[model samples]
Target: MRKALALAATLGTLAMTRALMRDRHVPLPTALPGRRETLSAPQVGTVAYYASPEGSGRPILLIHSINAAASAYETRPLYLHYRENRPVYALDLPGFGFSDRSRRRYTPRLMADAIHAVAAEIRARHGGETIDAIALSLSCSYLAKACLARPADYATIGLISPTGFDGRLSGEGPPDGHRGREILRDVLDRPLIGPLLFSGLASKVSIRFFLEKTFGATKIDEGLLDYAYATAHQPGAEHAPYCFIAGHLFPTDSTLLYDRLKLPVWMVHGQRGDFVDYRLAPRFAERPNWRIDSLPTGALPQFERLRAVTDCYDGFLASIRPSSPRG
Candidate 1:
């Protein structure tokens, strides 16, 4: 009993140390250039987005992936590229950036609604023209749900290194049906220890380590590293990340949404990195509206091979029509 008590005391001491060392105050910088806006959605708090101030063509929406330190910087390359000729916008998901980072139950449906709200804003700004939307990593699922909910709002859909199709297709379920690990959520939300654990995950070393895995190389983007570390240090930053860690943010089934999409779909992925799994992508190869392309870099291919990714994506955009039916 004495030894057990001693072990418990040691663990408690470590937990306290971590909690005490966690909070950081960093001024979050403006991620994109032109202009930023916010829209309130059902369930999702005030959602934030950035867009080109002036452009004269079909607008395109870019959604950054979800991670411990995700922001609009992830889609910087594409945003800048498209901003030259066409209107381009990037979103900072509900809890990640300058949006409402209040501690709440972040879920897939909420994220999809956030996207829907942003799409409505885009439609209002551009004479109600349908949008060309793209998403990286897990945001692809939210995009899918949004498109499924309002197919007419989107002209075409693009997925970059999307999840849910790594090995098999997603199973069918309601939009609210998620794969959240409630037990894990409770554990992570426990007093004191949760914040400490998130701090470690968002630490400089951990961010770079994950970035290396994302780039599949030791040389990662220094700017991204710097921004990620800065954003993770902001107040209330741990809320969404904790939900993600607890699996509350991912959809239970995205394959049905992907299959149901009849609008022109352009899917791109990189050959390198930890996310190079496109085994189930071929199932959609025969679909009349689905177009899949593979790049020669890591998960964040636009960072590694910007020109090539742009060329391929541009071709896909040029080939599609704005009124493409969602049959």
Candidate 2:
């Protein structure tokens, strides 16, 4: 009888596992705010974005962070705030959000090119006017690269909780040398287990856990979690996230770009969160073009202190004197 009981327990566990795996394989599309449009990026196929062109002068583009379940919704708080006063656009980077997430190797260069393509589309609509661009976390590197390549395309720049500047090895390795590449490659290329591993990482519970850690608070935004879970379950969502987890998204020369930037750069970060290490920021503290603000919240401070975030950013923009083309 005891032996039979053990057999029954093992079967029950296996059945539960199968049920969870089936659920992960099922796709679910998240309901995102704003009118969604697709840009034909030469390198990244179809890149999706949410645009609001109401009250406008120079447009503002908001780029969300890169992670296992990144989306335009991550910029919801800031997007809604900016759209009320200026033309605002939020991009769902390729391989994330509503963009094309077909199985492929996601790279930082691909992501940077997507930003450039989106900016070009915005410029065409706005009569070649340079727009203001902002990015969060790792996407900061991509935005920096984009601005560097096309300095004439951006009016001002904002970076929130940007990676690199940790005074440590957060972003010091060679751009091509990712320590976790071999492990991630095996995890993503192995038969059967590849999908299973992605499923485990993108499960609703796993996403929630990550958000809680990001917020560094028990009271994380529920709406963000709901959308994150939905987007994470979409078809091919794991492709980019696998690259991100393997540390392939960070650029090696991030600090060099930040130091060399001549346009007005506003950087706002927080004191609490898994990403609060800007000890090296003082190196550029006195730069005439760089404005740094430190807050008392987590990585996503805009979620809790929307007004503060916008006020500081807009203030920085207002202080900049419009100048001619640098090139």
lDDT of 1 by residue, 69-137 (tens): 999999998899889998999989988888889988899888888898899999998999999899998
lDDT of 2 by residue, 130-185 (tens): 89999998888788878888898988888999987886535555543333475766
| Model 2: ten consecutive residues of lowest lDDT | 171-180
Deviating ranges (above 4 Å) for candidate 2: 1-32, 168-180, 323-327
Candidate 1 accuracy as TM-score? 0.92
Clashing pairs in 2: none
lDDT of each: 0.86, 0.81
